[model samples]
Target: MRQGKVAEPVGAMVIPAQRGGVLFAVGGLNGELYVNGQALTGQWAEELRKHVPELSSDLDRLQAMRAEWLDSPPQDRTLALAGACTDRNCHTTH
Candidate 1:
């Protein structure tokens, strides 16, 4: 495996809106979304959805939104989160 690449088929939950949005990683005391206590991002979550028909409808709707966002490139500089995010004077250690 290379640093910029991932070996596919990483197992994950393809949770839908029907389950009230992925009950397992619904956050805790610190308000961080995690799966089995590990931070799993959307790039990784896509691995879970690629093989399932579960989120197809969402994919359709989101694709349309993606197209619209692409049309307005400048205004859509960053992906928006549905949670609270405050800009602090501190640095984020990524």
Candidate 2:
């Protein structure tokens, strides 16, 4: 995986659903978060949290919902880590 470089993703998990929107977590290389090559700094998580907060006042219920989502089936999937892909467009996957 590119040695100790953190900018490149060492691994990735893709969960595809035919009837759902997209939610992605992009980890920066060298601690710099970017989207379409634009740096987001500390605003990404904060912005997302504000838009999609806990689903309920009960933490347990929220946890259950998260578990359910995680357990759901995926349409097409890919599990990748460092050096897993050798492509010019390795920066992203559709």
Q: Could you tally the backbone clashes for each prediction?
A: 0, 6
Which tens-of-lDDT digit does each residue in 2-83 have in candidate 2?
A: 0122356322312222343222323333333232223333354344334334311222232333233345522222232222
Q: lDDT by residue for model 1 over 30-82, one digit each (tens)?
A: 32233323433555346435543454444443334334434552221222212
- Candidate 2 wrong stretches, greater than 4 Å: 1-7, 13-22, 33-40, 55-94
Global lDDT for candidate 1?
0.32
Off by over 4 Å in 1: 1-50, 74-94
Candidate 1: RMSD to truth? 13.0
Top model number, TM-score: 1
Q: All candidates' lDDT scores? A: 0.32, 0.30
TM-score of each: 0.30, 0.27
